[model samples]
Target: MPLALALSPFLVLGFGALLIMLAEAFGSRRGGMALGSTIVLFATGLTAAGLWMYGLENLKGLEAVAPWLLLDRFTLFFQMLLCLGSALAALTAGGYLPEHELDRGEFYALLLFATFGAMMVSASGDLLTLFLGLETMSLGAYAMTAFRKASPRATEGALKYFLLGSFAAAILLYGFALLYGATGHTDLAGISKVLRAGAVKDPMVVTSLVLILVGLVFKVSAVPFHAWTPDAYEGAPTPATTYMAVVVKAGAFAMMLRILLTAFGDAQSMSWSAGWPPVLAGIAVLTMTVANLVAGRQESVKRMLAYSSIAHAGYLLVGVVATMRAPQQAGASVLFYLLGYTVSTAGAFAALVLCGSRGRETVSYEDLAGIGRRHPAVALPLAFFALSLAGIPPTVGFFAKWFVFRAAVESGFYVLTIVAFLNSVLGAYYYIRVLVYMYMREPAVGAPVAVPMRSGYVVAAVILSAVMVIVLGVAPSDTLDVAVAAALSPG
Candidate 1:
C-alpha cells in the first residue's frame, strides 16, 4: 500500500478536525457539528478496519513511518476502538450539550482532535511520539473538563487535572531522557534490544522505569496516582466524562502495554525483569481493593462511576501481569476486556445522561429512585449496563472479567486472582445498588425534580452500545481471534 493510503485514517481525522474548526469559527449554525464529528470518526474507524482486512504486513511503505508509528494490527485494533468509543461520545454530546444549553461547536472539534491524538498514541513506537500523543490527548481532556467554565466544580476539576497531568508529563519526559541516555535510542525496539543484551548497567534506567510507570499508571487512574480521577470525571460534562473514561483509558492501557512489552520486556533476566511486575501487581491490588471500598461509600453516582473506572484499571493491570507467563492469552484478554469495557462503560454513562434533563440531573442514588418504574425505556438499558458492570450473567462484563481472571490463573497467580475475584464481588454491591434504587426505592417527596430527556442521538448511542454488548458477550470468538492475532503478531 502507498504510504498516504496507509495513513488515510490520520489524514481524514486531521482534515476533518480542521474543517470543523473552520466551520465553527465562521459558521453561525452549529446544528450538525456533532453528526459531522461522528461521521469523521466512523470514517477513520472504517478505514482502519479496511487496513486490518488488507493486512499491515502486506504494506511496503510502512518503513517510512517505522520506529515512530507502528501501523500494526494492535494499533489498528485500538484505532477502531477509540474511534468507535469517541463517536459514541460525540453522539451523546449531540443530545447532552443542547439540552443543557452548552451546545457549542468547539466540543465536537476537541473530541475529534482528542481522538486523533489517541490514535497516535496507539500507533506510536517511540518515546517521542508517545509523549507527543499523550500530551495532545491530555490537553484536549483538560480543556473538555473545564468546558463548563461557569461552574466552579468544572474549573476546580480542570485545574487539578491539568496541574497533576503536567507533573506526570514532566516525570515521563525526564524518564525518557534518562532512557535515551542509557540506551542511546528512543525507539522501543532499540531499547529492548539494548536491555536484553545487558549493555546498560546504569542505575538511572531503574529510576526512569519508576518515573515512567508512575506517569503511565496515572493515565489509567491506578491507585496511588489516581487522585485526579473522581473529580475530573464528576466535574466534566457527561459526554466528556465518557470520553475520559473510555477513550483516554484505552489509550493509556495501550501505551502501558506497548512500552512495557517493547521497551522493558527484557530489561534483565526473566527473574522479575526490571522488578516491574511485582510492583504493578501490588498497585493492582491496592487499586481494586481501595477503589471498590470507596466506590460503595460515595453519595454521588458520577463520583462512584469515577471510582469504578479506577477499579477496572486495576483489573486490566492483572492481565498485564499475566503476560509474564501467558503472554498471548494475557495480552489477548486485555484487548478483549477493553473492547467489552468500552461499550459497557459508554452505555452506563449515557444512561446517566438520559436519566435526567437539564433541570433534573441524576446526582445521587436518591435521584434514581423509582426511575425504573417511571421510565422503563431509560431504566431498562441502565439496568443492563449496571448488570454488565457488576459482571452479571449474559453480560459483557462477566466474560471480560472471566477472561482476565482465567488468564491470571493460567499464569500461576492464584493468590492474585483470588484477590481480584473477591474485589470484583465487593464491587458488585455498588453496581447492584444502582439498580436497587432505580427499581425498588422511591424519591423523597421534596427532592429536586429529575426527568429523562428525549434525544435521537443519545438513544442511538444507547441502543448501539447495548447491542454491541450482547454480541460481544454471547459470541466473542471472532473478536478474541482478532485480539489473539494482534497479540501474537510481530510489532
Candidate 2:
C-alpha cells in the first residue's frame, strides 16, 4: 500500500499518456491527442499536488518502497519540485505550441511521460530503475525537441540531442554493468555495503566509479561533456528547452546526490579515491569559467542562455563536491539551489515565449530591442528573471548562490567558492546586456514585432517566481530544513 501510494503520480501520468495514444489512434481528427494532452496535464498537476502534500505530511518517517523506489523525505521533496517545474513548463507549452504551428496531442502526452520518468529517476533506489526512468525521460524529450519537424533548425537540433543522448545512455549502462560486476549487486544500498566492506581495493571498483561519474557528468552538462547543450537548446522549441534546462537538471542532480550519499559512502573504498574530489572540483571551475566567458560572446540569446545553463550546472556541482567533502551542508545547499534554479529558469523561458511574434521564428538578442516601452509587462518579468539569473540580490539566484557558496566555504573549498563568485560576475554581463537591449535600446523602425497581451497563467508564472525569489531569500530556514532531512535518509 505504501509503495502504491508513493507511485501514484507516475501511474497517473502513464495512464494519461496511454489515453493520449488511444485518442490519437481512434479519433477522427488529429487534434484529438491535443485535447487528451491538455486534460492529462491538468489531471497530472492535481495528482502531483496531492502527492506532494501527502509526502510532506509524512516527511519525518518516510520509508523505502519495494527495493526499487524510495519514498523518503529526499525523494518526496524532489518529486514535488520536479512536478511543479514540469507543470509550469507544460502550461507555457500550452500557449506556445499552438502559436508556433506545432500543436499536436502527442506533444502533451510525451511531456507528461517525460515528467513521470523524471519523477521516477528522483525516487529510484536501484541502478536498474534509475536507468529505466532516465531513458523514458530522454526518449520523450527527443521526440519533443523535434516536434517542429518542418523547421531545419529544429530537426538538426533534435538529431544532435538524440545521438549524443544515446551515447551518454550507453556509457551510463556500461558503467552500471561494471558496477554490478564489481559489487555483485544492482541495488544502491547493496552496492554501498560491498564498497564499505574494506575489500574494495580492486581496480575494477575504481573503473566502475570512474565510468559512472563520466556518464552522469554528461547528463548534468559538466565541462568537457557539455557539447550537446547549446545546439539542442537553440534548436528545440523554446518551452521544451525550458523543460530541459529546469526539470531535467534537477532530476540528474538528484541522482548524482544519491549516488554520492549511498553508492559511494565509504571513503576508503577503491571507488572513493581522493583524486575524484579534486577532479570534480576542477570540472566545476572549468565549467563555470568557460561557459560564462563563452556565453558573453553569443549572438543568439537562446544559445547564450544555454551557456548560462551550463554555468549553473557548474555551480550545482560545487554543492555536490561540497557534499563529498562535508555531507551536512551539501544537503541543504543542493536542494535550495535547485529550487531557486527551477523558478528562475522557468521565468526566463516564459519571458522568451512571450517575446515570440506571430509567424516569426524567435531568435537573437537584437530581437528584444525597446521592449520595455512597448511591452512593460513582459519586459519587467524578463528583466527580473535576467537579474535573478545574474545573481542579483533580493532575487532567488542571489540566495541560491549564498547557500552553495556557504556550503563550499564550510567544506573548506575556498578555491571553488572564489571561482564560483568570479564566474557569477562574468555571467552578469550577458544577462544584463539582455536587459540593456530590452529597456535601453530603441526599437528598430519597421522591425516586425508583436507582444501578446498578458494571460493569467503568464502573469502567474512571473508572480510565482518573483514572490518565491523574495520569500525564499528572506525565509530560507524551513526550506533548508526540508532539504537537510531529505539528504540524511537511509534507503
lDDT (CA) for every model shown? 0.90, 0.79
lDDT of 2 at 397: 91
Model 2 TM-score, all chains together: 0.92
Which digits, one per residue and each the tens of the lDDT, describe model 1 over residues 1-491? 47887898999999999998888999888788888898999999999899899887777888899989988888989989999999999999999999999998899899999998999999999999999999999999999999999989989999999999999999889999999988999999998888878754568788888889989999999999999999999899999999999999999999998988878877352235456789899999999999999999999999999999999999999999888877789999999999999999999999889999987888788899999998989989988998998888688899899999999999999989999999999999999999999999888899875699999999989998999899888988899898988773212
Clashes per model (N, Cα, C within 3 A): 0, 2
Per-residue lDDT of model 2, residues 1-491, tens digit only: 65556566667778877877777667677644433454565565566566666654553433555458876667767766876677667667766776776767677778778978888888888999999889988898888888888889888989998999999888888888988998899889998898778535667777877888887888898898999899889888877898899888888988887776778766753122453566778889999999999999998889998999999999998988887666777777888899999988888887777776457544777778888888787778888889889998878798899999999999888988999999999999999999998889886788866555434555556676678777876787888886776674322
| Candidate 1 regions with alpha-carbon error over 4 angstroms | 267-270, 488-491
Taking all chains together, the TM-score of candidate 1 against the true structure is 0.98
Model 2 misplacement above 4 A: 20-65, 269-275, 445-450, 453-457, 488-491
Best by TM-score: 1
When summed lDDT is taken over every stretch of 10 residues in candidate 1, the lowest stretch is: 266-275
